[model samples]
Target: MGVIQLPSPPRILCFSFHILLILLQQTTAERELKFVVVVFRHGDRTPIVNFPTDLHKETEWPQGFGQLTKIGMQQLFELGQYTKERYSNFLNRTYSRQEFYLQSTDYDRTIMSALSYLSGLFPPSSSQIWNPGLLWQPIPVHILQKSSKQKLHFPLRDCPRFDELQNETQTSPEFQNRIQPYMDFLQTMAVNTGLELNHLKMLDNFQLWNTYDTLHCEDIHNYTLPVWATKDVINKMEKLAELSLLSLFGLYRREEKSRLQGGVLLNTILNSIKQAANSSKQGKMEVYSAHDTTIGALQIALNIFNGKLPPYAACQFFELYQESSGRYSIEMHYRNDSSKDPYVLTLPGCTSSCPLEKFAELVSPVITENWSKECGKQDKMKDIFLGFDVAVGLLCIFNLVLLYLLYHYGRCRRRNNYQDI
Candidate 1:
């Protein structure tokens, strides 16, 4: 073998300096994750009975309509397991009330989902196991029903301004143009569903979405679809629903719409992030269990929406990290599929790992100081009367027109006994 010679002292010194520089850079770039925020939709749930023509009956579902299924429970349990695995090293081995907080919308599916999630996230360790037979522990999931200030529901159903905005969107030339080709198909659907031809002009796009939802839910649970709910019909309904939903949050006035809807939730999450950064006592995780609309609205506000219906059990995640320099950075990830890793979502205006301050500034325009004021809630009586008048006017038209060719495009079609859904 050829003899190997040692380098001179100067050469060795240079090599040592290069190694030191590499270590210094590595240390400077290192970051420790400190906090997490997750906003997620509830697991699989039965559809509420809004589409009268569907064959699914509330009695057929063991838990009644709009309740969670066992499959849903298992799905969330898996999510919890995934979360536990993801943070096992970072979080304490035993459960700590001080490190985690959970909230959910006041619905059977969401509350159950939260519970199922907790069961998976923190199964009792040997130290905390209370009973020999039971492998789980109780964790509180906060919910408040019918609260005036709750920020979890989407589209802000009570907001007159949002309603007004929606009507405006429905009437825009672009909206009319988009739905023009589907008018006859819509009429055929209406007649097939027992909704009269005259009533077709009065049907809202959301109602069309409801019809699709009923069929979609039926398929998920292995229920046979009616002859009317053909694959072609479903495909069209899906397209319409996607268009209508995206338009509500993005098409006409994205920032303004966000200021009224998703911005409320965004504000809450940002403040929580700031508090976590500034305080030593902040919880390690904050979770909000809500619905698809909630996640869609939040994503739209953040300018990271993927322009598709968020599937059941979807999650939008915010993770905070403390860098070696003592500054904080945030990373956003979205998980809508259980089969693959969550997708890394970069804020529209920043790098993948964005600084906390810069992230806040970029999203400031969407945040609202007073949601009620921004939503046109000046006086109780004024809002009620105005809302009634708008509702009456709104029901006269299909908001998202589908009978434009057969009927006079913009003429109102009246319906009796109109009520909010």
Candidate 2:
């Protein structure tokens, strides 16, 4: 090598050094994770509502109906622990007002899940330990007071336009086409399960999911399943339920439906991201402990729904990173199964790490700025009614004028004839 090595050319060495410098700069730019938004479905829980024929009753659960179970708490705790490990470098070692925020839907399971998750995420340290006996410390899990206007969750009720959109979705060709294949099975299920097929909307996928969940949970606990609860039946029900879910927030009038259901949450997330970009007052990480419906709706809005129902404790992550070039990008990852690594999700028109500006532009179509005003429920009906009333009034006036003219002409003719006689 020494005999073959003539001194390297000065220009070549300088060019190589310049290339190395540029790469170092690029590596530095990729180091920072500026913000994070983690949205997770609440962990395993007792069925919210069970079928009438089910053997399991509300009394069997210690917290009664729709409450989080010990298993759910443990699931969330594990999720929080995983989150802590992933963000150990980005997030502060111990919880602080500036470093973390947690929110949950206004329900017993979701609120409790948020609290349980917090317990694992921020185990008290020596400096902040209020009670030496316990490793947990109180962390705020905020919730909006339940009202007619609940904007934080998906499938929000009390929105007249949302209900109208849902009705429209149900009647769309897509919905009909999807349901046609399942009609006979659903009809039989209805008769056998004491539901009315004519009132199918009342027993939509969410309701079917309740029945399936009760059975699944019972089976897990060694409770006997009915003869009809075969694997094929369960899988079919699951598929149809997934389709019904898609119709609720996707298909046909997807954008409008998203505006009414998932878009509100999207807007919240966007605003949080924007705020995080500009301000330090807000926390670096925002966590939402919500329901499967919430996750499904959000995924549908994002156009990343994988057609299967999100499992218990499934998580979706939105991470904001700043590159060495001083530009920010947003990366999305979905963790639907605990056993597998989270899947990296790219926006349709962008890469896995989509620039912040580009990400916002792509998502703008689904973000409803003012949800109520955008809904515009009564305006169309009012316009149609007003037009109808004006048309009727014009018709009445024309008829009246025609009758007067005819009467006048008849009188004139009669007078002329009498004068001639």
Candidate 3:
């Protein structure tokens, strides 16, 4: 044993140092939530449309189809109250226009939902009251017309590339694989439900969902259920309907579709966060009152969709935080159920308190600077422009050649006439 000196304790020392580094990261000081962004679906409402077999007609509902009911108002009010309580410390006791911005789709249901939510969020105190009879104060809720509602809503059907993506998703192996198992069931349901089997195959779950939701709502309100509308049957329909929705926004090239639709909203949200983070002023919240598609699109973009129709008044929260060390982070939570706490969500590759820069980096792929350009529409337009320029150039050259030929013939005719004279 020639001088076999005991190995130095470097390896053990290195292990101890590595463990301490992890411990330090784990025990970093807590961060405070600085700003909040809430995107929620409008509360429960009558079905948007009724099936032929549906006993529950749109006329039965007080406000007709798709309008927010009293129950819907209550749901949003409760959500607002809950929000008020949760951010009591963060928000000013009275509403400030500067501190909050509320926006909704142009639809009546969405606009009313925002108003309902505001009622619970900031009930006017004595001095703030414009009218003593009403506890509410008017808060501006912005909207974009149906023709221009792309940024706030989901499944923006205007983009041809998105339509192409949906077609591709339908034919994709994953979509085919997932739906194959349910084809027989869907066919049977279509027959009973009076929906065309082919149409069922090309499922628009959101549309199908209206039928089931109407029947379910009727049953809940003590209306007699149809013979085929048992609880189990409704549950099955609801599941399949959800699958249809999933298929629409999920599977092959989901990211690309998201970039066109949901990612637009995400880009807006991130831009808002960046603006808030960079600016010295701060706000308590921003609420985007929209539809179930809005929630689904956002959840899909965030990769945290629960794979079901988000219930009425479902709220998705994006909370911004400032750490003790002056670093900012983002946290997300989803409140689909009133009885339970909002589900805490972490970004795919980040911790609960994800740093703002890291959050942006993680979501960069989904966001787009130019929606039309990224959707391939702008490129198509560019190609059309080039083709149009070439066509115009050829037309101009042909006109010049025709003019030269005419001029030459006239000159020869005039020269012959002059020689004869």
Candidate 4:
């Protein structure tokens, strides 16, 4: 009681001091961000569809189905320039073989887009140039084999659950409401094009998707879409394509799907960042060259779609900055519209710059398979018991057969002994 007779400071002052200390701690924690990961859709591409009656069907395009157009290359190049400007501080003035890792799905358009982007992003700096004419430097762009379904690619690895989700999306009340207007638009399209409603449904098929992609590419490159297709129709068709991306990702209908594709990509980026932060060496930027589907899926996953599709040259940028206090922060920038400054992304509990570890933790639930739900409780143990029972029954049958053979042999031997006697 005597020792506590005098309170050192007022309770309000003490509380204020604690609050200030906490703020300082938070500020210190916020300073240590150090990695960047980016996943983006490929720039502009030719149409992936062409009507049967159209004069410039598949025959007009050189290397068929969903190839990148000249405009697509230009779009990626512009994107590269933008990237160079955005990360000028973190990245070396010149592109270094050691500093960057680029990967793409094994698709012609994606591969080409990645190459084009590299050309623009790392245009020969004054010091690195071997010849003035050669603006291109060799940078390794890794391609995942088409068969490696594990690696990130569009129309995500076929899972029955995802397929069911897609079906549900098609039939969902919200989707039905959204598509009702589009259905009316389809009827008009059918009347104008002399195609039946049934045939119009065929437009949703893979072949039709391919035709649309090819034509879209051609239009972008040379201002040549079918004459029957008016600017308004073309715009609508483009929106439909964007919608297709959202559908393919299954993000619009199911929150879980968003976590798998987009969330996984985010987690991967954060993991890379965490690794970079712990290391003494400066981390390299990660680049992904993929389809509009890839971008759409990712954006839907991140809940960042501005209700407009990402254009041919659209890019998403993730930057990790290390503060003077040795803390890290993350900032996401989207360059869907090249005309405007990139839009920043902010997640709850994290600022534009979030810690890598926290980011990974946040997305963990999405990537991890819910085994109990995926494999039903009843079916889970059925297979194990069924297999064990079958094995044991087979063993018992074999032993019984062996005993019978032994008994018969003994009887036969005794008969032979009696004959000898």
| Among all candidates shown, the one with the greatest TM-score | 3
Q: What order do candidates take by lDDT, descending?
A: 1, 3, 2, 4
Which tens-of-lDDT digit does each residue in 298-404 have in candidate 3? 87887778898998999999998888788899999999999999999898999987999999999888887888766666576778999999999999999999999
In candidate 1, stretches whose alpha carbon ends up further than 4 angstroms from where it belongs are 1-29, 196-205, 379-421
Candidate 3 worst ten-residue window by lDDT: 203-212
Weakest lDDT window of 10 consecutive positions for candidate 4: 368-377
TM-score of predicted model 3? 0.87
Please list the Cα RMSD from the true structure of every candidate, rounded to 1 decimal place: 15.4, 7.7, 7.7, 8.9
Worst 10 residues of 2 by lDDT: 196-205
Candidate 2: where is the Cα deviation over 4 Å?
1-3, 6-30, 148-150, 201-205, 377-421
Better model by lDDT: candidate 2 vs candidate 4: 2
Q: How far is 210's C-alpha from truth in model 4 (Å)?
A: 4.7
Number of the predicted model whose lDDT against the real structure is largest: 1
What is the C-alpha lDDT profile of model 1 across 1-421, one tens digit per residue? Answer: 9999999999999999999999988985687889999888888888866465767677887878888988889989998888888888677777788999999888889999999999999999888899879999998899957465866978777888887888787777767777778889878888777666544433344677667777888889899898877788899888877776778787778899999989889999999999999999999999998988899899999999887888888988899999888999999999999999999999988998999999999999999898778888787789899999999888767654546644653333322223321
TM-score of each: 0.82, 0.82, 0.87, 0.76
The better-scoring model by lDDT among 1 and 4 is: 1
